[model samples]
Structure formats: structure tokens, C-alpha cells
Target: MLILPILLAFQTAEGSGYKTNDFALLGSDGKKYTVKTLTKGKPVFLVNLYDMEGSQGIADLNRLSQMTMGKVRVVGLTTLSTRGRGLARVKELGVRFLVLGSDDPYSILDIVPRLVIKEAGSVSYLSNTLLLPDRRLTHVWEGYNRWTLKRMSQDALKYGHVRLKIDFSRFPEKLQRGYGEFYGLGPG
Candidate 1:
């Protein structure tokens, strides 16, 4: 009896204040960005990519860009130097989304402390994390998945740190089809 009630309260607290102390990366068109500054008052969708030459990375960016029509601010962070080759690739792909170069994966390091010392290789940075506009991390996915990416976009639109201009009903058909599928609404 008491156990059930205690669990419910714990869940509530988790949702309310789980995101904090996280950071993101932002860049583009020769502009530099600081995660600490960009998330000052808005939610952020931070994507870390190391292999920009791959098919999945390109596809992911394209899909994310479509959802970015003033919905969520998407930023791409890469470990490779964006010099002649990398720069041309990103620009040709029309990476209008912000792109940042990592002096170190400082953004990820600040949040997942273990990831900092872990001896993982390419697989590690491929993971993504979501942070609220005010630098609160709302969700984290250990690996890459389309469904999770889509859900993060939905959460940003629905309960984002900053309010959206249009109503949920006014959202495009693609967006409205599966709104709030993750939460599975029940008693608060």
C-alpha cells in the first residue's frame, strides 16, 4: 500500500527536475557557440556525430532539419576537424543546422561523468542527449534510434522549455500522427 504511493511520488519528482548540469554544442557559417549560452532560456536537441561521411549521419541530419521549422534548435557536434574536406561535406549537405567542433567532447563530458573516463571509441560519441532550453537535460538515449529522435522532437514541441507559437492541433500531419506516445498518459 505505502510502497505504491511512494513510487508514484518518486516518478513525479523524476520528471519535474531530472534535467540539469548538461550542455550542448552549436556552430555554423563560421560562427562559434557555447552550450552554456545557447541553452540559457530554450530547449536544445544536441546530436554528436563523428563520421560525417556515412549514410546514416547524412540521413539523420536531413530528417532532423525537416523537423526544425522553428520547432527545436538542432545542433551538431563533431570530433573531426571541419577543414577543407569536412567543411565541404557539411556545407554541400546543406547542414543549415548549427555545427560545432569539439576541442574535446566537453559537452558530453560535463553530463555523463563515467563517459569522461571510459575507454570507448567511435561508438561512444554516436550516442545523443537532450537538454532543455535552460540547460536541463530532459532525456538521454544510450544509442541512436529514429524513434527516440522523433520522441525528443515531440517532447520539445509539447512540453518544451519555451512555448511554441502554434497549437498541437495545428501541427503538421507528420507531427500530429504520434504525439505523446512515449508518456502513455495515466494518473499524474
Candidate 2:
């Protein structure tokens, strides 16, 4: 029923040639990091920070991190410099997850171009989360939704050998993905 439409919403006309190159990002500590090195085999939840802002963003991030605690590692990726206000916004949200930014911002865009919308002055992402389970990368996610989290939790339990108990009240049951496809660029 509703899921059909939601799934349709996430369908992308553009083919996604997701690269496997090690994605490097700068942390607030002035250190360079990569997802493989950081996760250490744990399931990693990669979120684009600016894709979400304000109170709702704060709550969703905090809860998602808490929900998958230990079972998954939550990390944030940004195009901002590690030393800037973008880092400050992470603190403002009170999200304790590790956040890293790319020194060459285009690198971040390269990884998830479908998520970005670039105009004359501003850029934005339609999706907020990328849930990377320990299994196939095909199932790697590009949006925030209870179904995806639930699926991720299942993946974590089965693949990462960890259990999870998450409340899905705050997130929508359908999908918070690809709303941008109709508007502009979308997850590729």
C-alpha cells in the first residue's frame, strides 16, 4: 500500500556507480579518518550532517545513535572544514557520534552526488542517513526511515553478532528518501 509509493519515491533514473575507494574525512581533532578504519568491522551508520538541522534533526540523530548503540557505529560526514561552525552544529545537536569532514569538499559530493542539490549559492541533500550493514553494499541505505533502521538492526544482529532494540515512533514508517528526485538531484 503506502510502502509501494514510498519505494517508488526512492527509485532513481540515474545509475549509481558507487565507488569503493576509501573515503577519507577530517575530524575535529585534526586527524584524517576513513570508514573502514573507523568501523573496525562494526556496522557503520554514515549520516550527512547538514542534511538535517534544528530540533527535529537533533532528536532523530540522537535517537538513531542510541537505538543502534554498540550494535552500530554512527558517524557524520560533512563538506565543511573540521574546525568550522559545522562542527559546532554537531555539538549543538548533542550527538556524541564521530563526525568527520572532507578537506576537499568535492570528495564528499563525489561519494553521494545523488543526495546533493547544488545551486548558484547553496547546496543540500535530500536524504540524511546511509546505513551500511555488514553485508552487501547493495543494501546500503541513503535515507532515514524506521523500516530501514529495522532492516539495519536485523542486519546488525545477523551479521555483526549484536542485538538491537529501537523505537521507531519518531521516524516515518514509509521512507524519508528521494523526495529530491522529483525536486532536483537524488541518491544515485
User: Against the true structure, whose TM-score is highest?
Assistant: 2
| Residue 36, model 1, lDDT | 61
RMSD of each: 10.4, 5.2
> Which pairs in model 2 have colliding backbones?
114-186
- Each model's lDDT comes to 0.49, 0.57
Evaluate model 1: give its TM-score. Answer: 0.57
Our tally of clashes for model 2 stands at 1
lDDT of 2 at 163: 78
Candidate 1 accuracy as lDDT: 0.49
Instruction: Report the lDDT tens digits of candidate 2 across residue range 43-144.
Output: 676665543344344466667877777767777666676667767766776756677776575576665444443332234442443334322232344466
TM-score (all chains, Cα) for each model: 0.57, 0.69
